[model samples]
Each structure stands twice: as structure tokens, then as C-alpha cells.
Target chain A: MEKKIYKPTDIDIERLSALARISLSDTEKESFSCDIATMATYVSSLLSDVSAEHEREARSLDELREDTPVECDCARDILALSPSLKEDHVAVPLVVGKDKEGDA
Target chain B: MNELIFRSLDEHKRALTAREYSSEELTRAYLERIEEKEPSINSFVSLCQDRAIDAAKESDERRRNGAPLSALDGIPYAAKDNIAVAGLPLRCGSRILEGYISPFDATVISRLKSSGCVLLGKTNLDEFAMGTDTETSANGRTKNPLDENRVTGGSSGGSAAAVAAYEAPFTLGSDTGGSVRQPAAFCGIVGLRPTYSALSRYGLVGFSPSLDTIGILSRSASECADIMNATVGADSRDATSRPFPASDLRALIGKDVRGMRIGVVREAIGEGLSEEVLEAMQVATDTLRSLGAKMTEISLPHLHAAYAVYYAFSSAEAASNLSRFDGVRYGYRAESCGSIEELYERSRAEGFGDEVKRRVLFGNFALSGENREKIYGRAVAMRKQIIAELSSVLSRCDLLLLPTASTHAYRAGVKKSALYCKDDLLCTLAALAGLPALSLPYHRDGKLPVGIQLMGPAFSEDRLFSVAHLLESALDRRESAK
Candidate 1:
């Protein structure tokens, strides 16, 4: 299989930051694009060189705790830590366009 | 009694018990040292002076009533900012979480508290514990106690420097990929990354869940063992934590290593290792050999791929973990945003440092498209191979010996590059395999100390500490003779 070469551009970084939900300044986009491109090339080389025969198994869930309900008083404390709280719940800026004032 | 700040945890405990010095006095001395050294070393992010003094007073009262909490009663220690301490700001060395106070104590902190260990404060780390040097911390870079110009290896640099500067007798640091051990090595102290799951990760801010471990840094291996003895146990809150049986780690310190076999990773000492560090490893191996331990060169062929594997796995996990820092619930929020997306984008953009942003972007890129299978999948496969190879090599010997880092701590503001990855390469092998590893300061190249790393099979901290204690004693004797 032919490997796809990675050459990150400012557009790619912009899209990636969007996907990551992180806004990048114009200066940051230029520099991060280069750094990501360099890292991508390095990772590509490393991936292409290594054999892919061995697959490591993740930890088994057999030892996981039983789903027993337990009361915790941490909710009040967690709400207190919120940047913006409406009553007992965390509040955030309107997500749906319909909820915005400018939207009809 | 001011010198009590430099004494071992055991010595401090004895002094407290013998009434030679009050816990209040001991805590005061450490607090004073922190005040004096903090400007030069830049270790602590928040100093819990009032709380520590109150705790010290409580400890004094307990001892006076003949009801001391534990062997570590009244001993002052610091925790890396990532570890949650109730009422203490858990900034995690990042602007993103600045002023975020923890509502609950981490399992390790609670355990330490139950034992009456006085918490001096929280130490700085790489922002979100992502970088090798503490320079990435938004709080400011932590300098090496020995040389202010040099970096304290990070992201546990502050914890290491705090101990090295005698600001605290011991401090807790978390290691994902050599964070604890590397900084410990750089600062010339004992740092142990216990077997994964040996210590609870419930309260440590996640970096790479599978690889993150709460570790201890102290002036002596025995103190690390003491802290380990008190802290290592299962927590139902953390599914990854196992039921680790309590062992008298201190009792194992002076045990004989007459027939113990140590494997020296041939790959570790190659190419990137500095001459001074390599020379230190040679002397350390020789010292261990003279102490009746046998040494053999062993190969873990997949070892060289550790940095790539670690980056692929850790970055992916870090991206996921850091995703929680949206503007809504907690932490730094962007001042003004019309939409949720902008809120998240602007908050993260403004809050996260450059290195963190780069990694998160890299993670997104790697996880998208065919790159996921080509990079992430192959990395997963290589991780298994690395683990298998290390297991096989470890089966032949009691422990693996290597350099904690490729070189001594670099100058502050050294650019992050591929070359810097070499610092984490040696330590990543043990981390990847979920085995216990320790960095013990063995030699000094000028003012900087070189650390020799010892890694052992899973849950083999007892034997690892035994070998390290012996090596530490021999090195001390040699230094005293000189």
C-alpha cells in the first residue's frame, strides 16, 4: 500500500483547530502548521518503518467495579466550580443558532 | 533545628516523636526554606503556609496525646499541581485551570493526610504535564536547584527542585512518560514511577490514562519507599488501581543483592547518550556489580520506537483528556463569545500554551483519515511488541538498568525538537510496559547530577528499591572518601 505523505498547510491547521474546538490566531496557525507538518512527517516515517504484526490488548473490564449506586455530596461543590451557573446547573452560551437573538 | 528540612522522612518522624523538635518547628523551617529558595528555584505554585501550620499543630497534639497518625506523621511534603488537594488551587501549571480550586483530595493526598503528613504546597509542572521541561508551565519555569540557568527536567521539575532545594523533604509527582524520574534525575534526587496501577490515579489530572502514575521524589530511596508504603493501595474510585498488598519497603532497603541479575539495555546507551551520562552509567553499573549484583547486556529491539509510540498514544489520550476544559463548566472561560463553538475555541486558544496546542492539533491530525490506522494503529502494535520484548528481557534479569535521560538538564528556553525526545525514550519503555522504574542520582558531571535508571517487572518495586538503596549507599561512601 502506498502511504499518503503529510504536508500540513494553514488551511489544514485551521480545520484541525476547528475540529479540536480550539481557536488559533493567525500567527499561531502559521507556526503550528509547520510544527504539525514536521511531527506528521516524523510519525509517518516511524509508522512506515515499524512492523504491524503485534497488537497489544487493552486492559480487561472483568475487574471493573460493580455499578452500584452510591450517594455523593460532590454535586454542590462541582456546581460551585462552574464558571457560569444557572441555579444548580452549569450555564453556557447558546449552542443552537435558533437560540441566538440575531437568528429569526 | 532549621536543618531538619533536609533530613529524611524517617529522621523527621523520629525527631517529632522524640520531642527534639515540634512538628510546628519542622513545618516552619520548610516553609522558610521554600520562601528563601522559591525565587531562585521557582518550585511552588501555591504555598499552604496556614493550613500546613494548622496540620502541624494537629500532628503535634496527636503525638502529645500518644496517638500519632502514622510513621510519616508531621512530615511536610508537596504535591505536583496536577494532584488534587482540597481547598488548594489545582492550576495544573496551566492558564486554562488557573484559580481552579480542588473540592476533593486525591486518593494519595487523603492517604497522606490520614497519616498526618503536612502538605507544604503544590509544585509547578509542565502545563497539563505535557512537556519534558517545566518551561511549558504557564506559572513560570522551574530552575534546577543546583544551577539556576539549567532546567529542572519536567513536567515534574518543581517537585524535584523542591526536594533538591530542601524546600520540602519529599514531594509527589505524576509520571506519564518519565515526568517524575527525568526531573528527579536532573535535580539529583530519588524519583520512583511505581508500577502502573500500584498507586491510585483517581485524583491526578489525566494526561495519558494508561501511562499516568503518581510517583514520589525524595532525598533518599528509603523515604520514597516509606511514602510508597503509605500510599500504594487499591481505590474503588479508580478502576485502574489494583489491590496492591502493603509491604515494609524500608525493611527491604538493606537486603542483599548478591545473586541479583540486572539487565543493561544495549539500546539505551547508544548514539544520543552524552559522554558524561554514559560514563556515569558505567560507574553505576560497576558499583552495582561490586555490590554483588551481576550485570548483563540485554536487547529490547523495539525500544528505539518508544518515543513514536508514546507520542502517538499519549497525544491521542491527552487530546481527549484536555477536551474537558471547555469554557462552560470550570476553568478559564473566554471573556465574550456569541456561540458555544467560539467559546470553546477562544477559551482553549487563549488558555492553552503553544506546546499544548501543537500536541492537540497533532492528535487531531493523527486520529483523522488513514493516518489513524497507519500511525495510531501501528503505534499500538509496536507498543505491544515493545512490551513483549521488555517482558522477555526482564524475565532474564531482576531489573533493567539505563540512563534516566540522554543528558543532563539543558539550558532554559532550549527549543523543543526531535532531539529532546531522546530524554523520554529510555524511561518510556518501562512506562509503556506498566513496570516500576526509579531514577537514582549516581554521578555528577560538574554541577549537574546524572541519574542511572532501574526498571523492573510489574510490582517489583521492592527489589528495585533494594538495588537502588545499595547503589545509593555505595555512591555516598565513594563521595565521602573523595
Candidate 2:
């Protein structure tokens, strides 16, 4: 099997930051890009031609707990901790709609 | 009253039982000492004054009725902010978790509370337990109690500092890689990172789930054993947790190390080790030899690759674990956002610190579809090899001894990013293998203390404590004889 070489660049870092849902400043991106490039060289050498085996078998189903629900009094406390809240649910910015100006 | 703050758990119990002072009085002394020393140490992120007092009073009452919970009934300790304590702010030393309060206690907290241990407050840490130095904490960096100009090595720095400063007798910290051991070494105290799954992790804010383990920082190895005895047990909430087979975790204390096989990791001794640390290691080895323990030199060929492998795997895990911190729920929210995606981006970008962003970006890069097979997959393979090598070595020897960090605590505000990566190599072997490791401080005259580490095979925490206690006592005698 041929192993593909991976070297992280500025574009790669930008793509990663976006994928990670984090907006980074240009300077920050540049700094991280440099660090990642350094790390890339180190990682490539250490991991070259290595292949991973499947992880050890997980606990069997019989060992797992029954998927059941029980009542508790934590809801009120949990709700109180939310940053923005409605009557019974956490509030967030619009998920599907466009701007207030209706540009979309 | 002030002296009570430094007393061991057993001594405190005897004092309380004999009515030298009430638990409330002892609690008050600690609180006052915290107030006095906090300016210099900056160890605590918050103070649970009211809660501690109430719990201390309750403990006093329990003792008055001759129904004290246990030996730890009146002891006060702090938890790293990353661990949940119901109704207390769980910022995790990051702005992202700012204003967030945990609704329920973590399993360890629950266990400690049940044992009648009073929670002094939450201590500081590197944001989300990412950095080796506590400098990255949003709360403020924790200074080494031994040297004001130096850092208490972190992400467990505050916990170690609190104990070292005598603001609290002991504190809880979490280890992933070397967070617990490094800080304990830096603060001149004992730190224990038990075998993974020996303690529950239900409420610990996960940085790297596979590597993360809640650890103890205290003045003595026996105290660590006491804390472990109280906290070690299986919990349904944490599936990984298992019942420790040993009934008495401290049963090995005071036992001689004669004929015990100690493997000295050869790679850890040369090149990068500071002169003082090398001398300390010599003293430790000489002490063990004098005590009749058999010391042999051993090497881990993969030791050089550990730093890169640890970062790759831990970063991948961190990326996944930290993905839950969007603005919708309990943490900080951006002022304005046109869409949910924007909210997440802005909230995270603003909320996270530089090191976090660096790791997240790198993690995502490594785990990306094209690179995942090359980086993360290979890291997985490398981890297995490391673990196998450690297991093989442990089979040959009862324990592995090495310096906990390459040097004593470095002065605060040094360029930490590169320096920390190198310093942490000594600590990752135990974390990678899920083995029990303990760090015992070796003091030097007019210089910061050096940490000598002992690692044993999985589930060997009891033996590790015994050996550490014997070594600690021997070191103490040597110091006094000087």
C-alpha cells in the first residue's frame, strides 16, 4: 500500500479552522500555519509507513446498561445555566433564515 | 490555628478527635491563610467560603455525635476548575465556559463530599488543560510556591500551588500526558496519576478522553493514597471506571524496597537533563540502592517519538471533545450573529485562547479526510507500540524510575510553547500506557525541587504509593542528616 504524504500549509490551516468552526485572524492563521508546518515534518517522519490495527474489542452488549430513562430534578438547574433561553428551551440565533433586511 | 493548615489528614483527625480545635476553627484558619497567601500564589479561581464553612460545621456535628464519616471527615481540599462542582462556576480556565455553572457534581466530587471532605474552592489551570504552564489560564497564572518568579507547571499548576503554599492540604488535578506530575514536580509536592479507569471521569471536562485521568496532588504519598481510597470506585455514569481490587491502597507503606526491581529509563537521563536534575536523580538512585533495591538500566527505543505521537493523538481527541462548546447552550455568546454557524465561529474564535486555537486547527488538519489516514491513524499505531514496549519493560521490572520533568520549574513568562513540548516528554509514557505514575519531590538547597517519577504496570497504584512513601522518608532523613 502506498502512503500519502501530508504537509499542512496556510490554505490547509484555513480550511481546518473553518471546518473547526473557528474564525482566526490573519496573523493567527500565519502563526499556526508555521507551527503546523513544523509539526508536519516531525509527524511525517515518525508515522511513515505505519499502519494501524483495529482497536481492541469493546465491552459486550450484556455489559452495557439498559437504555432506560429516569426522572430527576436537574432540569431546572440546567435550564438556569443556559446563556439565552425561551419558555422551556435554549434560545439561539436564526438557524435557517436570512438577515433582518430580508436580503435572502 | 495556622499550623493546622499544614497538618496531615491523620494528624488533623487526631486533633479534631481530641478537641484541639473544631473543624470549623480549622476551616477558618485555612480560609484566612488562603486570604493571606492568595495574593502571592493566585492558586484559587474561586473560594467556596460559605459552602466550606457549612460542610466543616456539619463535620464537627457528625464528630460531636460520634458518627464521623471517615478519617477524611473534616479535611478541606480544592478541585481544578475543569472538574464540576454543583452550582460553582466551571469555567475550565477558558472564556468559552465563562459564566457556566455545573448542575451536578462530578463523580469524584460526589465521592469526596460523601466522605465528608470539604471543598475549599476551584483552582486555576491552563485553559481547558491544554498548556504545560499555568500561564494560559484565563483566571491568571499560578506561581510556584517555592519561587515566586517561576511557574507551577500546569495544567494542574493551581492545584499543586495551593497544596505547596499550604492554602490547602491537598487538591485534585487531572492528568493527560503530564499535567498532574509536571505541576507536582514544579511545586515541590507529590502527585499521583493512577491507572486509567481507576477513578471515574463523568464530570471532568474532557481534553483528551483516552489520556485524561483525574489525579491527586498532596504533600505526601500516603495522603495521595488516602484520597485515592476515598475516591476510587466504579460508577455507572462512567463506564470506563472499575472497582479497584486492592482493599487497602496504603498497605505497602513502610515496606522495604529490598530486592525490588527498579528500571532506570536510560534515555531520560542524558543530553537535555539539567545538571541539578541529574544530581537529584543520582541521589534518588543512591538512596534506593542503599535501601537494597536492585536498579537496572533500561531503554524505550520509541521514547524519541513520544512527543509527536502524544500531541497528534491528544490533539485529535481534544478537537472532538471541544466541539460541544457552541454558543447555543451555557457558555459565552457573541453579541450579534446573523446565523448559527456565525455564532459558533465567533463564539469559539473569541472564547478560545491562542494555544487552544493552535491545537484545534492542527487537530482538524490532522483529522481531515486526506491526512487522517497518514497522521491520526499512524499515531494510533505508534501509541500501541509505545504501550506494548512499556508493558514488556514493566514485565521485566517492578517499576520504572526517571525524572518527572527535564528540569526544575522554569522561570515564569519564558517562551513556553517550544520549551513545554520538550519538558513534557518525560511524563507522556505513563499516560500513554494508562499506567500508575507518582512524582516525588527531591529538594535541593537554595534551588527549586526536582521531581523523581516512579511508574508501575496498570493497577499497581498501591505498590507505587508504598515505594514512593519509603523513598520520601529516606530522602527526608538524608536532608535532616545534612
Candidate 3:
């Protein structure tokens, strides 16, 4: 028995949007549903028949660049350019705790 | 209009050597023209007036002191905004990176600087270079220089327009599936997507890492070679960059095209190609044949699937590469959010344009766990097939000729979704194979130019530009004779 090819119309835009971490408005959601469906249909129609699988050859040890630390002169400048910095490091929102607003 | 702005790099060098005009005068003339034409064209995203003048002054001093840097010394050129020029805005034509400025120059920018090329300003592009037309830009659309109503095909439209409008002699652009070549074709200029890794991608903002190549747009193939000669080399910063010694790219210029083996892509010339474009290709073929070149018909089996393969791989890479913009370290951040996840979602949703969001979502879909093997995996295998097919054909022929685009420049408001496949059909093969390709314009009198592409094997830029130079010369002679 042969397997059924996935249909482009079956794409769950809400799920993909969640995975991509993009919050789409109602109108955008409607728009993307159609756009993604069209693109997927186009791609699926072309690629469904292809089954060839090939991988690039692994590089020899000598071909790889030696793993060594390189000097970086713009660390201070990079840090300064950050929008939110705490002391010497970039500040991020607490991952597993009350929000900054709650703490305040 | 100042004729100085229209001179080729070589002509400028010669005139400067003869003391015809100082670099300052040339730079100012370009700046003046840019100021006058910018209101209607809207090609530039930002200008570097003071710094450009300062660089010009320094270049003049170097020449006066008999210590000139390189052949490009004092030449004014614009770069696509995505390429970082230290202290300049690095917006990538997206609202997400609105206030961001690059802290350091990209490797190419530093290399061009060392060669004493004056930076005019940064040009507009598609948001994150994700779209075909410049209409997707957060900055205003870049109108075609020849016709304001029509678009300068993007995502390197601004760079092409700058050259077409004589705002600059030449400019730098990035091609990841025909961004550079398509725009150059529309604007009737020369565009080169050099062999992958021929030039370092250290400072270039990544769109699709594997396919993204820093391309050159100039008035002529010889000028493209001049710019490439100064910029092509390996950089430690870009691990994919190779130690290419293919310097003196213009060495074969003016060489006889006699007995040169050229293959015309059979599939590319058939249905879906515009009639005028086909006519232009016919004329180009006759011109090359008249010059004693051997032209034959060739076919690539996988050419039909190139667009699908390109969208899958490029979108996946784009999704991963863009994951760095999480509203944390750099770029725009959301105003208020409950958690980090919400912050990420809101910032990305509010910051990115519609086309970008669609691609990002589609990319995530392709790379998602259940669909990876079915979509992204298949694209990988298909890409290898394309590479194999192209490599095989290139082995037989010295060069492959095809249309750079299906049609000439179209109106600005034409949506991206409608022309999706047709727009990218001709340009994706070179990007997929990581081969060098050049787009040279050929057109009838007072008509929109049609670009004919020349593709060659990897690291074959020297030959590619040489043949392009030959064809360009033939066309120029024919044009002048008219």
C-alpha cells in the first residue's frame, strides 16, 4: 500500500504561527491562510514525486579550520548597543518567574 | 546632469589621474544629483554626505601624495542597506531594526574602504530581502529610474536604480535567488552574483545563508569585474569564504569570442517568457554568432522544480537565521508584555511586514517536526540533484545563457503572490548550484531592457565576466551605430 501525500490545504496556520512565535491579527491570519496554502500547493505539486536523498560529504580533519579563539574588539560597543543591559550583561525578561511588572 | 557621475570606474581613474576633476568635485556632483533625483526616485534609505566628502578629501590627498590605495580609490558607490557600514543605519529595510546602527563595518565594507571607494549612502531593499518587489519595504517603494510608475525589481532595486539614474557609477547588492540580478535586469544595468564564497559574507545580514551571495551592480561588466577584483578574498570571519586567487577578473576583456562554447537553456526560452524578451535573446544570439561564437541548445531536467526547492531551503534558513531577533539584545522591542514569549511574539508580529511574516510562518511549517522530512528534506535532496545537473551541463559548455527574468520591469502595485513562480523561474538555478551568474541587458530602441543571463561553473567568475564583457561590447557598438 502507498502512503497518502500531505495536502497543502491541511496546513494549520495557527499552529505554525505559534511555533514561529508570531501573533497574527485576524485579517493577517485570513490572508496568510490563503497565501501559505497557495505556496504549499505550488511546492507540493512540484516536490511530491521526488524521493532522492543525498547528503554532503563530511570534511576531512585537515579541511576544517582549527578551533581557536579569535580576538573580538567590539564587545563593549556591542553591549552598549543593546536595548536593555544590566551591569555587564544583556538583560532579558525572567524566564520562569513573576514578570518585571509584578516584581516592581 | 553632471557627466562625471556617469563615467565608468576606469574613465574616472584616468580623468582623475589627468587632474581633470578632484575626487571631491566628482563626489559632490554625485551627491548633488542624488539630492535632486531622490525625491522622485526614492532609491536611498539613508545618506552619508559628511563622511562621503571626508573620504573623498582623504582619497584626493592620497592621490596627490602619490600614495593611492587601489584602482577604486575615490570612486563613489552605494551599498544595499542590509550590508553594515559602521555607524550607519543597518535597517535591512525593515521597521524591526529601525534605530539600530552597525557598530563595525562588514568585511566587504572594510575591504572596499581599504580600496578607497567612497560610500555615498545605503539603498532601500525588500524587508529582510524576503520579497521580489521593493513594495514590501518599510521605507517607501523604489521607483524605476526609467519610468517612475514601474518598479525597480527588488530586493536590490534601490542599488540598481542608483546606477540607472546615474546617482552612482556602481553599487553593491546581495543576491539570494535573483534579488540582485532581477533588479539589474529591470533597471538595464549589469549585475553579477559571483560564485558562492568568492567574496566573504562576514558583515552581510543573512537572508538564506547557503544561497546568499554579495552581488555587484554596475554600468558594465568590466566595472563589475573591477569591483570584484578588489573585494574577492577569504576572510577568517566567514568560514564558508574560500581563499580565491581569481584576481584580475578583467584579464580576458576584449578577447575574441571565437569558438567559445555557449549553451542556450532550451526550457528557459520557451513558453511563459515575454515575446519582447525572446526577441532580445534572438538578437543577442545573432550578435554572438556573428562574432564567431558557438551556441547550442541545452536542457536541465531539474529546472522546473527550482522554485519549490529554493523556497523550502531559503525559507528554512531564513527562519533559523531570523531567530536571533527575539526582542532581547538588539533591534525593536515590544512596549508591554506579560512574559518573554509574549514579548517575542508581539515584537515580531508588530515589527515584521506582511510578506516577511508569511515567509517566516511558512518556513516554520516546512521545518516543523512532522513535516521536515516531507518538505524541507525533499528540498535538500532536490537541491543536490540541481547541483549535480548544473555541474554536468557546465562541464560540457563554457557558459549557459538564459533570461534573467520572465518579463521586463512591471508596474509597482503588482502583488508578489500572483507572479510567484514566473518571477523566480529563471534566476533560482544559479543560486541553488552556488554558481556564478551575470545578467547583461539587451533591448530594442527606447524599450524596456530585457536581461540575458550567463551562468558558468563555480569559481568561473573570470570567464563569466569576460564573455559578458564581449556581449556587452557588441551590444554597445550596435546601440551607438543606431
Candidate 4:
């Protein structure tokens, strides 16, 4: 099997930052690209060296928690902390169309 | 009052009980010290003067009524900024959560409060508890109390520094990788990362859920034990917490380790270790031997990969956990954003420091598509292997002894890449295994301090305390003789 190698590019940084929803400046992009590439290379080596003989079964979910309803004592307080709120509802920007569709 | 600020928690308790000093006086002394030293150390992000004094007054009333709480009653301590304290700002040393107040106290805080322990305030940490040096904190960098030009090792640097500088008798520091233990070493104090789930993490801001642990930093092993006794228990709020047999940890201290089998991790001392750290390890081993504790060299062959594994898992978890700060419900919200996406991007971009952004980006990459199997999956497997290896080795020994860090605390702003991972290399092994580890100040090279670390199997905190107490006394005697 061919050993995987990672060399992060500017495109990779842009894609990842988009996924993480974090904007980055050009300087941050260049620097983080290098750091990510270095770390990826290191993790690749660790993956390749992992012994396959010690593979164990996944944990059983027998202890899965039951669905139980509990009241949150600070529910009102939590909502009050929102950046924008309307009638006790946490108000967010419309996800679908732009301003025209939502307002109309 | 000046001397009162430097005394141990137990001593403060004794003095408080004897009416030699009031809890109000003790609290005021610490507050004054914090006021004086905080400018130089930058340890506290917030000072709870009004709250602390009120709590101290209440504690004095309780003491007067002959109803003292736990051993730590009337004693003041600080919490890392990540731990939630009711009505206090939970900035987490980041600009994102600035001015965000916690509505409720964390389970540990409530436990401490119920025991009459007064809160001094929240100390600084690496932003989101992501970095080893507290330098990454968005609030500001914490300077080592011992040397102003040097860094107080982080992400609990401020907490460790507060205790070391006598601003607080002890403090709570959360350990994900080496957050607590590393800073404790750097600040010349004692820090313990208890077994994962030994202490409740219900109120701690999440970093890496699997590895994040609430730990204690103090002037002595006994004090750490005392605090642990008060805080350690099962909590319904945190499902990961489990019930353990109740034991008095303070009673375990001062007991001799006559037949304790200590394992010296051979790989920990090889290459990358400094001469002073190596000498300190040697003296630690000899001191343990002199105290009649047996020592044997043990190896964890896969230990070298600890940093890689730790970063992979912790970064991935951090990415998921921090996504909650999306400029929506709470935290910093960017103004003049055209869309929700822009809101998130702008807020996080402005809020997170470089180190945090770097890790978050790496996390996203690690968990995406094929990289999930190649990176995250394999790292998980490696973690299991490492845990198994540690468990096997620990089966033969009572504890594993090693240096907490490869070298003494470095000067502030030493931007060498090699120094970044060095803090976690020696300490991550125990963290990965979910075992308890303690870093105790061992040797001081001129002004800087070196700490020796000990790792014990799960729930072996009592035994670790006993061994550490004996070793601390032995080292003290040797120092006094010189």
C-alpha cells in the first residue's frame, strides 16, 4: 500500500475555513497552510505506524441513555442572553432567500 | 497579614479556627496581594472582590456559630477562566466570550462553595484552552511570577501563577493535555490531573471532551488531596462521572511508601530531555529509593506518538465544541454582516487568536471525508493501543515517574516551533490513558523551577498522594541538609 502524504495548499485552507465558518486574512492563510501541512504529515506517519493487530470492537450502546424530559431552570435566562431576540424567540437571519422573500 | 497570604490552606484553616485571624482578613490579604502583583503577573482576568468578601463574611459567621464547613472553609482560591462561576465573566481568555456571564455555577464551583471555600476570581488561560503557554490568551499573556520576562506555562498559567505568587493558596485548573500540570511545573507548585471523570466537568468549557479534566493546583500534595476530597464525586449533570469508593485523601498523605513499586518510563528520559531535567529525575528516583520505594525501568514503545495522537483527537473535538460560538445565541456578534454565514466568519475571525484558528482549521481537515479514516480513525486506534500499553505497564508498578516538561520554563515569546509540542510530549501519555497524573516541584535551577511528574493507574489517586507526600518530605530534608 502506498503511504499517504499531505501537503496542504491555499485551496485546502480556504475550503477548511469555509467549513469551519471562520474567515482568515491572506497572511493567516499562508501561515496556517504551512502549519496544517506539517501537522498532517506528522499525523500521517502516526496513522501508518498504528498496529492493526490491536483492533478492538466498538463500545456497545447498551448503556445508552433513555429519553427523559427535564426542565431547564435557566431557560429564560439563556434566551435573554441571545444577541438578537424577538418575542422570547432567538432571532436569527433568514436562512432561505434574501431580504425580499422573508419580508414579503 | 502579609505572612497569612503565603501560608498553606491547612494553616489558614487552623488560624481561622483559632481566631488568630478572621476569614475576612485572609480574603482581604489575598485580594490586596492580587491587586499589587496582578499588574506584573497578569494572572487574573477578573477579581471577585465584592463576592469574595461577602463569602468570607459568611464563612466567619459559620465559624463563629461553631459550624465550620470542610477543611477548606474560609480559604480563598481561584478558578481558571474556563470554569463557570455564577454571575462572573467566563471570557475563557478569548475575545469571543468577552462580557459573557455564567448564569449558574459549575458543579465543582458549587461543591467548593458549599464547603465554604471563597472564590478569589477567574484566572487567565489560553484561548479556549488550546495552547500550552498562556501567551495565546486573547486577554493578555501571563508572566511567570518567578521571572517576569518568562512565560507562566499554560493553558492554566494564570491559575498556577496565582498560587505560586501567593495571590491564592490554591486554584482550579482544567487539564486537557497538560494545561494544569505544565503550568504547575513552570510556576514551581503542585498540580494534579485526576483520572478522567474523577472530577465533574459539567461546568468546564469543553476543549476535548474525552481528555478534558478539572484538576487542582496547590502548594503541597496534601492540599491538592484535601481539595480533591471535597470535589471528587459522581455528578448526575455529567454522565461521564461514575461513583468511586469514598476515601479520605488527606488521611492517605504522610503515609510511608515502604513497598511502593514506582516505574520510571525509560522512553521519557531519552533524547529531547535537558541535563537539568535529567538530573532532577535521577534525584527523584534516588529519593524515592531512599524512602524504601522500589523503582524499575519500564517502556511504552508507542509513547513517542503521543503528541500526534493528542493533537488529532483534541483538535477535532475542539472544532466541534467551539462551533457553538456562532454569533447566534451568545458570545461576540459581528456588526454589519450581510448574511448569517458572514456573521459567523467575521465573529470567529475577530474573536479567536492565531493558535485557536490554526487548531480549528486542522480539526476541520482531519474530520473531512477520507481524512476521517486516514487521520481521525487511525489516531483513535493509536490512542487505544497507547492506553492498553500504559495499563499493562501500570499493572506491574504503582506509578510511573517522569519529568513534567523537557526543560525549565523558557523566556516569554520564544517562538521556536520545537518548544510548542515539548510541553505535551511527556505529559500526554497519562492523559491519553485517562489516568491520574501529578506534577510536583522537584528542583530549582537558579530562578526557574523543574517539576517531576508521576502517573498512576485509574482511581489510584490515594496511592499517588501517599507516594508524592513521602517524596516531597524526602526532597525537603535533602534541601535543608545542603
What's the count of clashing pairs in each model shown?
Answer: 0, 0, 0, 0
- Residues B24-102 of candidate 4 have per-residue lDDT tens digits of 9999999999999988899999988998999999999999999999767899999999999988999998889977998
C-alpha positional error of residue B243 in candidate 1 after TM-score superposition, expressed in Å = 1.3
* Candidate 4 segments whose C-alpha is farther than 4 A from its true place: A55-104, B416-419, B445-447, B476-482
Cα lDDT tens digits, model 3, B205-272, are 97799999999999889889899988998999999999776658876566777998899998888788
Q: Candidate 3 chain A: worst 10 consecutive residues by lDDT?
A: A53-62
Docking class of 3: acceptable
lDDT scores in order: 0.84, 0.85, 0.85, 0.85
**Of 3 and 4, the candidate ranking higher by TM-score:** 4
Which candidate, 1 or 4, has the higher DockQ? 4
Model 1 Cα displacement at A60 (Å)? 15
TM-score of predicted structure 3: 0.90
Off by over 4 Å in 2: A1-11, A49-104, B418-420, B477-482
Q: Please provide, for model 1 over B334-353, each residue's C-alpha lDDT reduced to its tens digit, 9 standing for 90 to 100.
A: 98699878899899988998
Ranking by lDDT: 4, 2, 3, 1
Error at B68, model 1, angstroms = 0.6
- TM-scores of all predicted structures: 0.90, 0.90, 0.90, 0.91
Model 1 agreement with the true structure over A1-104: per-residue lDDT tens digits: 33455565522876788878998888888888877777766666665555535632422211477799878889886655445756986555432343445322
Considering just chain B, what TM-score does every model have?
0.97, 0.97, 0.97, 0.97
Q: What's the CA error at residue B229 for candidate 3, in Å?
A: 0.5
Clashing pairs in 1: none
List the candidate 3 regions with Cα displacement exceeding 4 Å: A1-9, A51-104, B418-421, B476-482
CA lDDT, candidate 1, residue B352? 91
